[model samples]
Target: MIETAAREQRSAEPVVRPVRPRKLGKVPFVELADGRLQGVVSSGSDLARVYVSSISAATHGFSCSTNNNRPCGGLSGGSPCKHLRALADEAVLQYGLDRVTRYLRVEAGDDDDLMSRLDGTREAAPAAGVFSRFLRHLAYLELPGSTAPIAEMHWFPAVSAEVR
Candidate 1:
């Protein structure tokens, strides 16, 4: 049994770590297409918008209406709520954090190029409202509802025992 275990461990396949269970809002929208790689997490009542900034991949932004005092997530929170960690974890798991940051930077560059290309055809005067144009172009993602609220779930750490 010891020899078999050693052989398996030596195999070329990348080691797979068990994923930790998330204890925050449900994520229904994760957009990586526009290069921002944004996610919207909702808990039926409140919503949190988390995104990789176009300015910097290493930089992360999160906004939640409930966070009127201080940001509840990892970025700004003193305690670092699970919701913040969960969104970041989801992005990192899909694309390593480094790669995601680089990708966002590249995408931001592409956006600039596109804007410059359309400069001639673009409006000479600003829109009715300052951010009206920007808001019109923004994409809104909605989260699905669960039969039972996530807050009610019982969570515990995993454990294993070996007999001698």
Candidate 2:
């Protein structure tokens, strides 16, 4: 694992790489962490609700539910719900297709669709963990912009200090 201090001590020069960005409307939050591709996906039916969906990296086990713990009706045994698919697609955008492919241990040719290649089963997993993480991330966005170091972030490296 990369340590915050170690990362902070690196060279000041910016390292350039191919950039990829995604619209936040569909799947606002996506991540490849905790051994799964998980995120909060907007609900198509209800404007007030968002679904938390996840696909396991090992077995591609799937689950989707509202933040309120209501299961998504679309998650049948044969396939993952649209929210899960959206989450995976957004993950690929956030983390390159190659990274995601390697993380999930999926083998696919360049021309193949990512989801179509996955053979997954409907797994009854809890949504609380994923949803709570999403909420915590949102909380950071609400914090007032400040250069002052936060006490809670003592371990975080201030790489921005190197810019100027």
lDDT of 1 by residue, 6-89 (tens): 535653322333333444336433435432444544444444433221111233323322212233334343332444345445
At residue 46, candidate 2 shows an lDDT of 83
lDDT of 2 by residue, 1-164 (tens): 55444545765334434336779998889877899888899999888999999888999888898999898989755688788888878888777788789989998666777888889888877689998998899999898899976776644434431233
Where does candidate 2 clash, by residue pair? none
Model 2 collision count: 0
For model 1, state the Cα shift of residue 106 in Å.
14
What C-alpha lDDT, on a 0 to 100 scale, does residue 79 get in candidate 2?
Answer: 81
Please give each candidate's TM-score.
0.30, 0.77
Q: What C-alpha lDDT, on a 0 to 100 scale, does residue 77 get in candidate 1? A: 38
Estimate the lDDT of model 1.
0.36
Candidate 2 residue runs with Cα over 4 Å from true position: 1-19, 149-164
State model 2's lDDT: 0.81
